[model samples]
Target: MGRGRQKAKHTKIARELKYDTYNVNYSALEKELGHPGDDQYVDKWADQYADDDEELETA
Candidate 1:
């Protein structure tokens, strides 16, 4: 497609998105926001490469 046509199509989509509103699920949002006792993340690769990381830091 021509550049002008592509630009006009983008402008139309942008205008529609700017004015449109949709329903929000507040309960899901709250759940995703945070929860206590949810800090169980573990990076096994970082742990495995601990010696290499220390060598880089010292250099």
Candidate 2:
């Protein structure tokens, strides 16, 4: 397709998305936003690499 035609099609789709309204799942939104705490993840190699990271920082 030509450039103008492609741009027009994209603009039409963009307008539809901008104006479209649909039902929102508030429970899912709440669940997604409720968790703010860190997962308390531990890296296996973090202890071994800690010395290397410190040396690089010092240099």
| Model 2 per-residue lDDT tens digits across residues 14-59 | 9999999988999999989675568666577886655777789999
lDDT of 1 by residue, 1-59 (tens): 59999999999999999998978999999888765466876566875665876799999
How does residue 43 of candidate 2 score in lDDT? 72
- What residue runs in model 1 are displaced by over 4 Å at the alpha carbon? 37-59
The deviation in Å at residue 23 for candidate 1 is 1.5
Q: What is each predicted model's overall lDDT from 0 to 1?
A: 0.83, 0.84
Candidate 2, residue 38: how far the Cα is off, in Å: 14
lDDT of 1 at 47: 54
Worst 10-residue lDDT window, candidate 1:
34-43
Leading candidate by lDDT: 2
Q: Residue pairs in steric clash, candidate 1?
A: none
TM-score of 2: 0.49
lDDT of 2: 0.84
Return the lDDT, model 2, position 6. Answer: 95
Question: Which pairs clash inside model 2?
Answer: none
